[model samples]
Structure formats: structure tokens, C-alpha cells
Target: MLQELVLDVRKALESSRPQRQADSSFDRIKSSFACQFSSVNPRAFLPWGFVRHRTSKWIWTNEVTQPGGDAPIGARAFRKDFTPPLGKTPAQADIIMTVDNGLTLYVNGGQVGTGGDFRFAEHFCVALRPCLNVFAVTGLNAGVPLACLPPSKSHTPTAPPPLSFPTPLGAIPLRWTPAIAQGAYGVAPWGQITIPSTTPVLSLTAANWIWTSEVVNGNAPAGARYFRRTYYPPTGQTVTSATVIIVADDAYSLTVNGVPVGSGTDFHIAQTYTVNLAPAPYVVFAVVATNGGTVNNPAGLLVAVEIMSQCNCISGAYFISDGSWKFNTGTSVGFELPGFDDSKWPAAVIEGP
Candidate 1:
């Protein structure tokens, strides 16, 4: 009878031990689940319900400055001002803005739109005036103060495509050809060269040209300067194409007989300007140039004009740049007109032999 009682006691202890083990295992599983779900870091894995589809391309600012713990939790204000191009109608203009967590956008002191939540980026399109536009954004950090967690390997994004591509268009234009249509899907082969259909009308070396400026030789003044030269066309010469290759230290705007033709902002590369000139007694070429404002940067303008004259007699007669050019320190009203007076302007000094 004693032996039987000992066996019963042993069975009771074994049963209670398993129950205690199960309770301990249950606690461990619960703790793991909570740890996986509780993350405040942006790079950490968020629940499927928290993920959202982006509406547009993300345009991050060049300077990213995330706030520290001591910073405010929400409602930080940022303002930027921009001037739209002149003569752009309201129908042709729109503005878009976004921030890290949430923001409210404003244009010209008027509230355009607002967005909240970190999942979706903020985007807005509004008619803009041609004048100075004031843009303001208020961003909020919607992060929960919790322990940071690691992103799960299963939720990592797949590898991106080799070619650059944007979001697909809802409707393709009707004018798209088969090759062009395939390009929209980012299927174009890498390093493919696109040959331009139009041929260059005129190409000439700068051997017959002179780099010149109105200011002291080799020192470019820090403001816009005007340059002008008159061309007298030979009568009965039918000019088919007229092209000018120009390069400046900072920027230049070209005009032919009071009509703007082209402008260039790049200083490293030369720009080409082409215009069809009707048969006229005279053609006035004017360029408004500005120094780049960087000290020790070479400041000069080089130009080469090429005109296709049907008559061989006038081939090289009027299409050349020389010491006949004059320049002034500032812009003048109606400076591009053929009859505009440049008598007071100083003769341009040759920059190079």
C-alpha cells in the first residue's frame, strides 16, 4: 500500500510540471509578438495595414535634417518663395509639395491643401500667379515613441529595374509610334543613342571670331552688359538659313532685329541659335551678357555667325564678327531694334589673339 501511494504522488507532480511549462511558453510567444509589432523607426517593418501606395514621385529636399528628441512632436513650419516664368497662364502652371510625415501647402498666402499620415506623401496642384509665389509647409512627426525594431526579411522590397522609369501613364498619346510606345515602359536598351532627325544648318569654327567684353579686359563686371553689331545684307541674296554659335562666361540672351531668338544659362558649353531672316536691308544682332559673379572666373563672349547665301558673291560678306561690335554696361530699352542708338557704348576689347 505504501508503494502505490508513492506512484500516485509522482503522477500528480508530472502533470503539474507540464502545465507550468505551457504557461511559460505562452508568455514567451506573447512577448515576441509585441516586440515585432512595436517599432517607431521609419526603416522598420510596419504592419500591412499601415502601408500605402504613393500617388506621385517623391521629391526629397536636397538638405534633410531630421529633428532630435527634444524637438517638437508636430506642427513645424517651413516657407519658400519662387517666381514663376513670365507670361505663364494659370492653366499652364501648377505647384506640388510634400514632407516627411505631414504638411499643409500654401501659395501666395492662400492655403492650397493639407495632408496627414506618414504612409502617403503630400501632393497638390493649384493655379499659380505669374508673380512671386510664397510657399509654406507645416510638417508633423507622427511617430509613436517606442523601441525601434528591425525590418523583417520577408517584407524587404524587390530589386529595382536597371533603367530609370516613372509611374505608368493612364493613357498614352495617340501620336506615339511603336518604338516610342515601347520606350514609355522603360524597355529601351541601355546606352542606346538617339540620332536627331533635323540636320544642323550651319557649322563653323571660331577661328574668325573674337572673345570680347565691354569691361576691362580679362575682368568680367558683375552685371548685365549689352553687345550689338549691325549686318547689312547684300541685295538679291536669298538667305536660306542663319545660325549663330555663342558662348559666354555666365549667361546671354540673343535677339535679331528686336525679336528674341534664344538664351543660354550654361557657361561651360556653347549654345546654338537659329533664325530665318527675311530679305532685308539690315539685320541687328544683340546679346545681353552677365558675369557669373565668381571671382577669377574668365568672363568673355565668343560668337560665330553662319549664313547660307544663295549668291556666291555674298557668301562671306556680312556673316562675320569683328571689332565692329560695341558694348554698354547695362541693358537699354529697345536695344535690339535696328535703329537703336549705340553711339555712347564703348567698343568691345578683343580678349584673345
Candidate 2:
């Protein structure tokens, strides 16, 4: 029994090696770069926003249900403090951000970027110290109604209401595109909004990843569809960590190299899947998405995958959703296989405003 127990312990420890190695590799990269390769806009690649209100939930730029502070209707301040890996000082660092009305950003008590016209969002880069740091943002919710009409002779106009229309400002699209296929909504059951579906992927880097599908129009088919994309890791570099963000209308499951890593059932919020994978020459990514319910129910899939290597290849070479992805609504047995031919599969269609 003691021998068996020892063997079990060894097996458990061996099972953890991949994760530990990845973690160690990531640390080494950080140490080598001295925090120079750190992402400026860590949240830029996500499908959502930063400010989470008790009233408005995760949806971005919606009406604030619970305004805070003495000036309930004025600007709100947000701050996040982080400690960069200790190393050499960075001569220059950058940040990209935007807010509804306007904002003034600060890094370690130094002003980085200030508010803009609210029509355009910009990226900001700055210098940084390699130790503990403070990153702060003051979001301005300008009181003026977004699309308010001026008072007319026929009717009296009170204060205009806040902007209700979804604006592309402040929020960055990891990649913004409409659904590829247009088909009838399916009868897939709407699962309850579980806790996992509501919570945001905390460490996810928002790079404005684009959404893709097989169809070209806004209308998507009712039934489920299969999609696949392939990625070849950079040579001579070890993959340290990988994460994916998926938001589907009805439901979906994502698998890497035949191993299921993440899935989403609720259509409410984006779900994040993270895993430490062993380095490989190539990785196969597949997804099975279903758009259910009545015809009126819209269908789409937005995905973003982040793969970090020992070489720090975060943005480049990583597979992001785009027209380049080959997708098919029909089962083509062996589609998930890396060597399978997809020349006949339709290219992902991009239909969006």
C-alpha cells in the first residue's frame, strides 16, 4: 500500500509539470524583458468594458443604474494597481483607453492621457518603473443627452436622456464583425445564466478580436454549426500559456487538439477558457456552435485566443477570428484533423455595421 501511495504521489507530481514549466517560462520571459513586453492595454482584446456597476452589470456604456458619490450624475473614477515583475526599468511604456464623456489617466501619480471629444478613443504610451505601479482611470459620464432633441414650439423639452445608442467609442473591438451565416434560429434550450458565464475572464487581454461565421448575412441558421482553425507555434519557442474568450448566441464548445478546454451555454456574457498546454509543433482549434430559438433570435460567435510563448508572441502569429478561418455548417468527417483538406469549406463571412 505504501508503494502504491508513493507511485500515486509521483504520478500526481508528474501531471503538474506542464503547468509548472509554463509558469516558469513566463517568469523567465518577464525577467528577460524587464516588463518592456507587458501589454499596454491589457483589456483591449476583450469583448466587454472595464467599469462594472452594481446596476448596469457587464454590458458596456449602458445606463448607470446606481450612480455613486456626491455628484451622482458626474464623472466616476476607477483605479487598478499592479506590481510589474521586478527587473530593469522600462524607458518607455504605453497605454490605450477611452471613456464616454472624457477621462484623465494616471500612472504612478504621473498624468498619462486626458479626456478626448468622446467620439474617438486613442492609445497612450508612457515610461514606467519596474516595481510596484498604480494605473488609474477617471471615467467622465458627461450629463448631456446623446441624441436629445432641442425644444420645439410644438412641445416643451426637458433635460435630454443619456445616450442609449451603442457607440464604438471608449470600448475597443478585439475584432468587430457580424455573424457569417444567416439561418433560422434553432430550438436549443436557453440555459440559466450560471456564475461562470457572468464572470469576466480576469486576466484576458482584450485585443479586439473579430467575430466570424459561415454565413454572409445577419440571419444565421437555427441549428448548430462546426468551425475549426489551426495554429503553428513559432519554432524554437515553448508555449507557456493559452486562453480563449468565446461569446455565442445559443451555445458552443471549444476544443484544442481534440481536448475540450472551454465551452459556453448562456448567450448573455462572454466566457473565458484558460489552460496551460504542453508545447507542440502545431495546435488544432475547433468549435461547435448552435444558434437556437425562434427566427427572431440573432446568432453569432465572437472569439479571441491568446497564446503566450517563451518568445513573447502575444499579438502576432496567434489565431484570431477573421475571414481567413474556414468553416462549414455540414459535417465533413475529419474536418477537425490537422491534415484534413478544407479547400472546399466556405471562408468565414464578415457582415456587420
Candidate 3:
């Protein structure tokens, strides 16, 4: 297969420039890497629900955040191991690949290519080894939401067999899979590596991190900052479930309609909670964020709330810690109640993501 790839490229160079071809395989490639989104050029990618071969799907590690999910910035390792057909090694093979933010690609432990801007795909050509071949990638997600499309395929002029594959994000400390991050399913990150313990809830992606105006340059007044936000159930309907994630710089205590829900201290790891509101026509979410320190220091709050209304489970209401929430520097014991008057309070400040 590698030999055929080499001959294919060699013949193309020997002859006039080979026109780029677009077939089922190429169409799949374009759908994933041609642009940052299929919406950018509808004709450049496959339509939604288009059945595709399982051999190709986007994959990532469990640690890699999906679009809108936040995490400590870092990189994860992935590998694809395969043995090409026995024959004289190919002189060269051309492959194309792309990622959401950036990637450093390696083959047999050697760096081959790197791409940062996901808006455009990249092309790479390298010599193939006669024995076992390994394709490894170092995927870097600078911030929220990241994933790598499955790497490119190698084709021989005479034999068009694909040469490399299996890409997905793992939920574990490490993960590997063949085309695991299919775009249709909210595109799970990092292949099959699912570490639910570390996975941030999906709804958080639609929310934001927020705090009071006292927070400046990520440093807030060294004291308590009160926050409250309200949500109303659909007219003539009630809500049955609400899921919320809260993270504060130092500590936080969350409440729903004046009832205690949950709390957390370490801001590095977000805490999630579910509250029942089966009979309520409206709801209020409250939090007391404490930036514990003698002087000003880094402090902020991030909360993501989601609820499914009884009228239509498909219709959801989301509330993030944002400017819509009111804040008070002083304490108020019953601030979380649905009838609490917060109209005079200032809106919460928006800290950086």
C-alpha cells in the first residue's frame, strides 16, 4: 500500500500537476477539515445524517474539552499503529490533517508536521518505513473546546488502500480509537476515553463565568460577593429538573429557591448538582462567593445552570453566571428565595473565560 502511495505521488509529479480529486473519501475529508465549520461552505462538506464508513470519525481524549467546555489548558497524546502491506517502502506519501486549535504530528517517533489554525487543513509528505508504522499526535487545546479530526489517508497510485487511522478522544488518562469523535453526536472529544469524573457537564458550554464588578484583573475584593439569578418556568407549566455547575476562586455555597443545593471550595474542579422544582412557577439561584485573603487576590465565580421544563422536554432554559445575575457586597440571608427583591442590586461582572 505504501509502495502504491509512493508510485501514485511519483507519477503525479512525473506528469502534469494532478488535479485534486473529490470522491466519497475526499468528501469526508472536506467535511471535517475543509473549514472551521460545515456552515461556512455548505457544499464543501457532507450533509448531516450522511452515513459514513466507521473507519473515519473525529476522536479525542476525555480531558480535551468539547466546544464551550472549559478546562486547565494542556496537551494530550494519541497514537495510531498499523503495519502496511509487506513490500519495498514507499519513497513518499502525502497526507492531510487538521485540528480545532493545534497539533504536533509524529510518525515513528519523529516530528513530521504541525498545524495551529484549524480554519485550513494541512498537507504532509513523508517516507514510509518497511516494518511497523506508527502515527502519533500531540494535541493541544489552549482553552475551552478542542478536538482533532482523524488524520489523513495515504494512497498508492495502483493500490488506493488507506494507510493510517483510528482517531478519538479518550475519557481516561490516555485513549485511542478509530474515528470516535463523529460530528453528529455533539462530537464527543478524545475518542472513547471517557473519564466522567473529569468530564465537565455538556450544558456548561453554553454558559459563562461571572462575578461582581469588584473583580478587577482577576483580583476581587477580599471578602464575600453575593450573586442571584432567577428563571421562570414556561407559562402554565412547571419545571421538574435543574442541573447546575459552580466554581469559585476560593469558596461557594449554592441554593435553589432558598433551599441548599451544594457548595465547593477548590475552583480548579467544578462541582455539579441537581435540584427538584416540580411545582414551582419560578426559580431563583443564589451563591455566596468568598475570596479568602488578607488583600486583593485572584477571585471570580463561574456557574452554568440548565433546566428542562415540563411542557416540552426538548425545550431547556439555561442560566450562566453573567451580567443578568444581580450581586450584593453585603449579606442577605434569604437572597435565594423566589420572591426576593433584587431589582435594586447591580448586575454581576463578567470575568474572562
The whole-model lDDT of each prediction reads 0.43, 0.43, 0.54
Tens digit per residue, CA lDDT, model 2, 124-203? 33444443344544455455321100110010112331231111111213232211111111111111111111122332
| Best candidate according to lDDT | 3
Q: Residue by residue across 146-209, what tens digits does model 1's lDDT show?
A: 0000110010112321111110111222322111011111111211111111234433342233
Instruction: Give the winner by TM-score.
Output: 3
| Candidate 3 per-residue C-alpha lDDT over 131-153 given as tens digits, one digit per residue, 9 for 90 to 100 | 34456666565674655444323
TM-score of each: 0.39, 0.39, 0.44
Where does candidate 1 stray beyond 4 Å?
Answer: 1-204, 207-217, 294-297, 310-320
Error of 2 at 314 (Å): 9.3
Off by over 4 Å in 2: 1-217, 294-297, 311-319
C-alpha positional error of residue 321 in candidate 3 after TM-score superposition, expressed in Å: 1.6
Which runs of model 3 end up more than 4 angstroms from their true locations? 1-203, 312-314
Error of 3 at 45 (Å): 35
User: Which of 2 and 3 is the better model by lDDT?
Assistant: 3
